[model samples]
Target: MKSIVPCLWFSDDNCEAAVNYYVSIFPNSSIESMSYYPDEALDEHFIGKTNKVITAEFILNGQRLMALDGGPVFRFHEAVSFTIECEDQAEIDYYWEKLSHVPAAEQCGWVKDQFGLSWQIVPYNMGSLIQSDAQIQAMMAMKKIIITELENA
Candidate 1:
């Protein structure tokens, strides 16, 4: 079977730092392999990044992911995001605390990290919890998912 590996594009030279941050946050996560840009590259875009990480493959909670320093021409946006399904409110808060960096972009359990990657920190039973309009409203008002509030709503 052809396996699909998700890739994250970090702006300019921050890919390695972002990969390290992610690995530190999750248990059982580590860098699988890394490759650097050619030291003698002719492209102006990669001039100072010769010693920087070109590609870094890593695992997050057993899920494999790849990241690269693809220059400032491209960036991570809300169009693509990683969703973390939390077992409880504590799990939700933990991931939220670790990933949330852009306060202005936060809404409805979704937040943008320092790397500008969007992440949805939500409850595992989100589908069941948002069945009612009240519950949905409660969730929509939250930056991080609150399980008990959703249940009470």
Candidate 2:
């Protein structure tokens, strides 16, 4: 495992959804495990009901991401987004298409999944370029470059 990994909680079939999504995007990615609740249970109330997924894991661009069917108490939002520092526009474009499956989510360089996970797709050195700028015109130029790239797609 890496020093840190992202764990996402979802409701119902969210585990499956996440697996399908990330694996499809990352070239060498694949689902590791998927376990469903058993039909018979220990308790009277638990009988024939789905309780939990034993484990669910997948790899995205060689990064490990985990998911669980832990219900809707927790959710994904823009407040916590995963940023992809892509090498070039092609890399950004590839992620943009794979991650932004939701048609209405293409906005402000951010996109949301059906499960509401927010992701920021950007070029690798874009952030440093913006931070290094001391002049307003320089920042504007950088912004224009990103917008132009996005538009050209």
Candidate 3:
């Protein structure tokens, strides 16, 4: 087993869809394996997961992650997120287009994906770009980060 892997919990029982969607969006990504729940659930709590995906292991942009159909006991929130260091506006835009799903959750450089996972799509050196208060204010006003605007500010 990998020393450490971020496991994603999907209370919706759509682990397969979430894994496939993420792999499709990210480059250098692939589904390593997917284990299905037994037809006859081993426990009463697993009844909802019967015939569904018990877990899926995958690699997204060289990062190993596991996703599971862990019924509605928990959910994804904004406290934890993945950060994508983009080299340019195009890279940021590409990831934004593919990952931003929840419109209301957008702020600064944070975006929520279809699976409710949060992601920070930003330039490689955002600190150097948004050094001034003006630039910080400019970034705060927008959802998808505009590198040019931040630099100009």
Q: Which residue segments of model 1 deviate by more than 4 Å?
A: 41-45
Model 3, 1-153: lDDT tens digits are: 648999999988788998999999888999999999976656776565667888999999999999988888999999999999999999999999999999999999999998888999999999998899999999999999999999899
| Model 2 TM-score relative to the real fold | 0.71
User: Considering summed lDDT, which 10 consecutive residues are worst modelled in model 2?
Assistant: 136-145
lDDT of all predictions: 0.91, 0.65, 0.91
Cα RMSD of all models vs. native, in order, equals: 1.4, 4.7, 1.7
lDDT of 1 at 67: 93
Off by over 4 Å in 2: 40-54, 101-108, 131-153
**Deviation (Å) of 59 in candidate 3:** 0.3
lDDT of 2 by residue, 1-153 (tens): 547878877765567767787787778788877776665555674344464563588787788878877665677667888887777767777777677756565554576766678787776666554443343244343421363433333
Q: Residue 18, candidate 2: how far off, in angstroms?
A: 1.7
C-alpha lDDT (0 to 100) for residue 120 of candidate 3: 98
Q: What lDDT score is found at residue 39 in candidate 2?
A: 53
lDDT of 3: 0.91
